[model samples]
Each structure stands twice: as structure tokens, then as C-alpha cells.
Target: MIRHLVLFKLNEGVSRDEERVVAGVKAFQELDGVVPELTFWECAWNITDRPIAHDFAINSAVADRDALTRYLEHPAHQAAAARWREFATWVIADYEF
Candidate 1:
């Protein structure tokens, strides 16, 4: 399986409480049902206030690299990512399990 993990940092002046950010997070949270390739999905706001911590995170799993690619290419995922791109930057890591 491929575990796809991401950490998101909100841009300056952006807050997780903002309606747009909330909706963006919801969009990502809903991806488990939208993308067939995704076998697992978990997304949430970060509760920690440490300077090194990000504002949000996504932890997902897929069967393989091909499934991961499909998940990435899925339209719903693309739309959610575009919305987040406006207010946040992210880093990701994929690992096999």
C-alpha cells in the first residue's frame, strides 16, 4: 500500500476559521467517497500551536503507486487542491507499507 501524507501551512493572513478554508478542508475530508483509488482517508486541523507545526494534515492510503496516481488525478481531488492552493502551501510524503 502507499501511504500519502501531507502537511499544510496556511498563507499569511489566512485563518482556518475562514469560511473558504473550512470549505476547502471539507472538500478534502470528503475525498474518500469521491476517489475510488483511495482506500483510506483522514484529514484534520492541527490542534498544536508549535511554530514547526502545520495548520492541517491529510493521511491517506491507496493500493499502489498507480492507485496513488489516480487519486492525484481525480477531478474532485484536483478541485479541492486548487481551492487550498489559494490559501495554503503544503508538503507531502508517500511511503510504502
Candidate 2:
């Protein structure tokens, strides 16, 4: 399996609450339904007083390299990227075995 993780820095005008960010991340559940290769997806955000993560981070598990490739090029992913690009300053992603 491939473990995919990403940390994001949100744009200046975007809100930075943990629950709201988690809600946004939960939206990936829908993508999993549409894109079969994604075995798991989850995200969390930093808190106001207690930062749980750096900015925003996503953790996903996929079947293999091909599955990861499929997830990356999927239309559902593109839509998700477009949604995130609107309020993200920058994003860092990594994949592991």
C-alpha cells in the first residue's frame, strides 16, 4: 500500500478552524466513492489554541503505484484540487511504502 500525506498552507483570507478544515477534508469521502482506487482518505486542520497539524494535512492509503497514479489523474481529484487551490497558499505532498 502507498501512504499519501500532504500539508497545506492556506491563503490569507481563508478561515483556519479545525472543524471547518476537517469538514472540507471529509469531502474526499465522496471522491472515494467515485474513484475506486483510493482505499482511504482523511484530513485535519490546525486549531486556534492547539494546533494539531501544520496548516492542513491529508492522509490517504492506496493500493499501489498504479492506484496512486489513478487517484492523481482522476477527474474527482482534479475537482478537489480546484476546490482547494482557491484558498491554499501552498501544499506539500509525500508518498510512502
In model 1, where is the ten-residue run with the lowest total lDDT?
A: 25-34
Report the lDDT tens digits of candidate 2 across residue range 1-97.
8888777777666775545445556565467568888788776665554543457767888998898888889987877777677667555555666
Number of colliding residue pairs in model 1: 0
Stretches of candidate 2 exceeding 4 Å from the true structure: 16-26, 48-53
| Candidate 2, pairs of clashing residues | none
Error of 2 at 18 (Å): 13
In candidate 1, list every pair of residues with a backbone clash.
none
lDDT of candidate 2?
A: 0.71
Which one is best on TM-score? Answer: 1
The 10 consecutive residues of candidate 2 with the worst lDDT sum are 45-54
